[model samples]
Target: MPVVPVGRSADNAVTTSPQRQRPTIAIVGAGIAGLAAAWELVAGPDSQGGDGPEVVVLESSDRIGGKLRSTEFAGRNVDLAADAFLAQRPEATGLCDELDLTGELVPVGASGASIWARGRLRPMPEGLSLGVPTRSWWPFYRSGILSTGESLRVATDLVVPHRGTVGVTGDRSVGDIVGERLGRPIVERLVDPLIGGIHAGGVDDLSAAATFPQLIAASRQSGSLLRQLGRARVPAPRSAAPPPLFWSLRGTTASLAVALAGALARRGVAVHTGVSVDAVERAGPAGANGATHPSWTIALGGSGPPPTGAVVMADGTSSLRVDGVVLAAPAREAAVLLGPLAPVAAGLLSAVEYASVALVTLAFDPGAIRSPLHGTGFLVPRISTFDGRPALITGCTYLGRKWPHLARPGDELLRVSVGRFGDSRPAGLDDDELTAAVFAELTRLLDIVGTPVETMVTRWNGAFPQYRVGHLDRVARIEQSVAELGGVAVAGATYRGVGIPACIGSGQTAARLVLESLSAGADPAGRSPGRVDPTR
Candidate 1:
């Protein structure tokens, strides 16, 4: 491996360990990634007596753990927002155990889904298969979502010949793959809404490699997704998981914030809320690890000049001089800041797109809905567009049915996520207008005649990131650019993934890079043993 030259800090110590009595590691965002990095660095299997990385978590928001908001409504707990991270992801679940939060972990309910495709609440295709179909007509036959013809079309995937090679380096759009394998209707009726809801992109715009990589891999390995029925290794179930683990959480996801906060606290990480970061830059000694920009300097006051180190900008900030750096913010945020500094990386980051969304949580009386929300909830297909934007009820969860610990029988919770990219409702619409719009749509779709008992509208201006086709190429270019820049590492939804697990993976990966860089700088090994390839 070749060594990259970098600026060095003459003052600070090169190494950090628990035995040093005081070792500090700074994290900019308090979201799962930031908190997870803090948890692992301070409390993971690596926590030993060699001067542990003392952690300092800074947040621009008033609270820590961005987006995972579980709150109270009408005296019962609710997760109006992000529910649970997929248990199969393992990163988030693993942290839960490391933090002793194993008991708080809960499974999602699986009463099944109600589709609104052919215009009715039919059961979601019997064997979900996500975007991939298994039984010829499972989704169409089993789901009220599609027609018999549509079901037949979807089954055709069994014979859909392999087009391109798929692997970590391969890429394909969900729309392209689905439509090619399954006809247009199945793509529209089943694939559009289901895959669209999760990705927040028009199927044509989302990447199969990034958004539904597993399904893509399955399609590759099985050679026939339709035939791999009795066998697909489904997402694993949790200790107290609901519905065998394939959907969102029942209650509000706010507790994820609470749990993470508790974990960071126990590990002695200083949580700073309501503080904003301005920029990040490289200035660390080229630790034997070529990736470590050992000296990092950051400007904090938003206007005044500031601090530096292996500075990790986990916030929604821009470039600053720092030795080691990690960016755990969203894709757009990363692009905005890194654009001027690392144009190639920034452009690649920019290539990875995002979609806007609005989530409306509605609380209804148990008797109002046509059927009990048995499982997690229903999903709205991207095809069911409202005013050019996909408008999906995404099904309502019978909060009372899923979790025994939450909600009374009479009190029911329904989270109706509304909108996808550029939904043109009047910008001036009052809260009442938004609320009315959500309820009206739900009532018309689910046959619920009554009004919601409670309501909330969360507008994530740029909440969901869209990973498009050719995304892999762009990210690879990004990695190359950053590698040349030296000593700086980037993580978060922008490069690798968007979910909680993806973000956790990205952030920890950044930390690991920094650690690895430190290791490389000191050790003659030059890089991780596996990474030391002479092929290049």
Candidate 2:
């Protein structure tokens, strides 16, 4: 492990002479997480020692914004990846507020979504908490997805006796607990679709404690999950209006990323795109030169050219020495960077698997769909099949209906998401093949009257991380181990969460750890792990 110089003050942290040296911190990766980290270092309050340190962001790719990207299409802007984020979570909305984007933030439309299952599109049952209906029978039975007998079996959950404290231990899969209490039918039809949609992973493999804390907390009570959820449900006040449950910029999400980069530029934080840091290693005591601050040697030029400014400082070499480093790449990349330095943490990170999903956006004439489009979109149950085979397309969202701004009169824009965990159909299909498949599915489900005017197919390979059972435990261990390494911190969707908000929070928190260690000139292992609030 690399050891930072611990004897020098800010006045003489890293210079050869008596002149003072401002600590130089390098953020590897310019994705949302990496950008968020730079935001923290340059914007956070001055440390007890003095002012903030000099910083630089290095990205392997020419483009920024890892997943939050949007572009002009169909004469309007639309997100290619995630369209909206969970507004209920403060991490993302808080960033929007800080960035002064409140006015542009818009909630999803009033239209709700339907479920495509049992060979039909049925209205989703009301009172579903991530697929667990509040009651046993009413909504589930009326949904028509479940038969009368199956509906009665769900009702048994309300009267069923205790199963010796399910989901009370370390951690369990959502499918296990939900199936044990509510029945497998509900797990297959309801839980898998909603929760699985969010993670793109199987409910049977997802960690209940890590993914649905609220459900697990409520389940610990005396009643069933349904009764507990019913008791916990708080009705909104009729007099007061509720805000939007999801939010995004008026334009593309990429605008936010661009705005953040511009903000970093204004702060004089060196921004370097198309530069990849191949390796991070300890400068060794010989390179530390008796200074108390830790020293790092960053190797560049594997994925892209090194930054121009950094190239000179590299003195014609492929490596440059820095005071500290923040690793904000995806889990797979992070694992590769950490393998030589922190083998254990790298191994833990490599163990986390990822899934690939493809999005097909199509524009059609408003009159093309003869039937009135109902709700925002429809999610196909995993059990759904087309011509006696598993359905390739997972879900569909009517963009124009959901957000009126994206379409003009007589225009209908639809975004279709295809693929799931352990499914290779999405990645295997080309643009034409995927578009035809999704279009065929949409026609089969909605009976469209005409062909699409324009269409786009975007494939995201290994973008979503699967939070398998014991995810929290793995994250805790990963963090603890990294803390011991002292001068480095890791942040991204791979660690705590996978949403925009979670990634931002993780970046900010990682920056804090790096800044703190640099300021104190001490080993991080001796101090508390980190300041990030895991609950958020």
lDDT score of model 1?
Answer: 0.60
Q: Quick one: best lDDT, which candidate?
A: 2
Candidate 2 deviant stretches above 4 angstroms: 1-18, 45-50, 135-137, 163-167, 231-240, 285-287, 302-305, 308-317, 524-536
| Per-prediction backbone clash count | 57, 6
Per-residue lDDT, model 2, residue 366, is 71
TM-score of each: 0.81, 0.90
Candidate 1: where are CA atoms >4 Å away? 1-24, 135-144, 159-170, 218-225, 228-243, 246-252, 284-293, 302-323, 371-374, 385-395, 426-428, 483-487, 522-536
Model 2: per-residue Cα lDDT at residue 454: 93
lDDT of 2 by residue, 1-536 (tens): 22222233323434322254577788998888999998888875572244677788998887888787887888888989978887777877888787788888877774568888777788887777888887445867888877777777878877876554655567888998888777788888878988988888889999988788767766676666678877676654566667666776787666778888888887887667777888887654222455455566777764455543343322444555577789998888888987766677788899989988999999898789875677778888788888887887788888876776675896888899988899998777789988998888888888788799999998899878999989998888877777666668999989788888889999999999887776677654333223222221
TM-score of 2: 0.90
The local distance difference test score of each candidate is 0.60, 0.77
How many Å off is the CA of 105 in candidate 1? 1.6
